[model samples]
Target: MNRFLQQPIWRFYDQSISMKYNSPLESFATDDTLCQLVGQLQSPPTIRTWVHDAAVVLGIQDHRLPYVQQGMKVLEARGYHPIVRNSGGLAVALDTGVLNISIVLSEQAEALSIDAGYDVMVALVKALFPEAADKIEAYEIVGSYCPGSYDLSIQGKKFAGISQRRLRQGVAVQIYLCIEGSGAKRAALIRDFYEVSLQGEETKFAYPQIVPSVMASLSELVDASLTVDTVVIRLQQILHDLAHEVHMEPFHDEELTLYSFYLQRVLQRNAKMLEPK
Candidate 1:
């Protein structure tokens, strides 16, 4: 286990319930706000879990795709809202089955190394599923969207990817866990997205050649009956045991104002990125 995951106190934020009403944009903005609040010592270390109905979160580099808009249409046609996220990574599919977790920690004492932050998330995830402790592996899964060095996998099939955002002396390490549905199906969507976006035309950046077979959900990899709700329960139990005090704290009035500011920025950036080129 990483030292950062052993905080004495932790504030839990559960947004998984109201996922239908919230967009991925709002979630990203809330993360930014939490980053500021936690970094400034206004709040304790926080763990936020969220899920969105369905969206194709594109990375900044992805916005430059030759036929990006056409590719977005392919997603929208399939009921997936397309939006370029404020973080770094290639496009990732999100739906009711996928669980997104964010660990917001302050970096005031000393800046946490990038690798250290990623390791913290890897540790927490392994703790989440003890039965698969030895099975779970972290390495890049080629042919998967948003391929990264810390891609979480089991038996060579990826089920999660970790990305980090640092702002205002805080580090937000985020991961999307494919918990319930078929992970390969989600990867297929990204495969179609990239196929449409690239149209076989070469570009400066090398977009992933997504292979759907390279991914599998936790349910498929470990237990067929696993679900987001059950995973959430496990998360709470783990947090309770790890921290001396674990509780949910509502947003402060000041924090709400700050959240609004960050929300607008995210919205504006998305609008500009998705506009016709």
Candidate 2:
């Protein structure tokens, strides 16, 4: 048994229920909020689930594109609002069908290594879909958007990607799972985004040469119709089976107040990221 999958306690938060913080900006802030709390020992190791409607969360590298303004405009035209995130990844499409999970953990004695954080997320995902446990592979899917060593794929098609954020004394391991809808279509959106953002301009950074066919949804890859709700249920069941105690507590007033402060910081950072050059 992987120790990463043997977490004794887990605090669960399902934002998909209220659909309140379903926007990209709110989603990022929510993670930051929980990360700060857990890092401060105000909360336990946490697992949060959220889904945004339509947004493209870009990384710092993507913001430096020669024609980034044009790319943002392109995304806006396509009904996907673009925002640069405080994480390490290129442009990734987010929608109703995509499920985002954040595992926030406190740095007990030593700082968690980056690879260790990613491994935890990978283990969590595999645990969530134990039926397809061996099928999940963590490797960079060449030509996939936001290509990374931890891009989660099955067979040859990529469906999810893991990224980590560390703050204070906490680590937030995040994964965006394409639970439903057309994964190739999402890839195409990023491909077009790069096309518009780069506009034949050369740069020090190497952007991904996205191949839409290489990206797919978990539903398509597993050959089973997995909706966001269905996956959330599976997550709850998995946690229940794996953990000795699963805490599902609503945010208190103090937490909400602290969240507002973190959210404000995120908003300001995003506004600056989206500002015209």
Candidate 3:
């Protein structure tokens, strides 16, 4: 039973546990909760979408920046809240223009390779935009924010990047797609952030040297104006068409209760990361 080939997808896009509304922490914690629920088979395989307004989600490694405090201040002053996420990747900007999709898979289906998870997302994203699917390629977009091998690109400019989180018996493959606004401006923001954060301090891990030109929004790449809401509907339709059963499942009372615990776990982890030295 290949899960990817024959799993019913539960849509949890509109109904999520991010009660905090604008807090990226809420979004992150909710993902953790969903991962746990799906892991325990309390919930079906799920697809969730979220957008946090004016936020810069940092990787754990990003906390080591020589002047990270100052770098955070820069982001704050620029109207973006800076947060450290437990997910894979570094320094991604989120706003109304950016849309995040998480595909939750129950480990019961089988143990899937990392590439297999990423391929699932890449395939879905391409499927969502068949008009430009042929041009969308996944590779490491050098000089781009959060550069990764699964970076989804058009020509040489990247529009999205895939990341993942594994917990208990579930795997959540996540991707952030730049759907509208200026992707270069977002890259430039991170570029300036690193300049302030690094401040000439050498670190064990090499951070990306962001080149704004290497990043772009899907609208820019595809030459069409796209909005998050529009994409959300399209994604839901695609999933509905692909799966024999598509159910709208929200968090149950037990899951909500569990969310409080996971939320604290995420909060504590973030506190440790952002704790002042």
Predicted structure with the largest lDDT when compared to the true one: 1
Compared with the true structure, the alpha-carbon lDDT of candidate 2 equals 0.87
The lDDT for every candidate, in the order shown, is 0.92, 0.87, 0.85
Worst 10 residues of 3 by lDDT: 12-21
lDDT of 3 by residue, 1-277 (tens): 2348356556555532243247788777888888888887878888888877889999988998889999999999999988899988899998888888898887875787899999889888888888898999999999999998999999999999999999988889989899989999999999999999999888888999999999999989885678887888887787777787888766778788988998898888888999886
What is candidate 3's CA lDDT for residue 172?
90
- Lowest lDDT block of 10, candidate 2: 16-25
So what's the TM-score on candidate 1?
A: 0.98
The candidates, ranked best first by TM-score, are 1, 2, 3
- In candidate 2, which residue ranges exceed 4 Å CA deviation? none
Clashing pairs in 1: none
1 or 3: which has the higher lDDT?
1
Residue lDDT tens for model 1, 1-277:
6788888999999998876457899999999999999998889999999999889899999999999999999999999999888888999999988999999999998689999999999999999999998999888999888999999999999999999988999899999999999898999999999999999998999999999999989999999988998998999999998899997876789899999999999999999999999
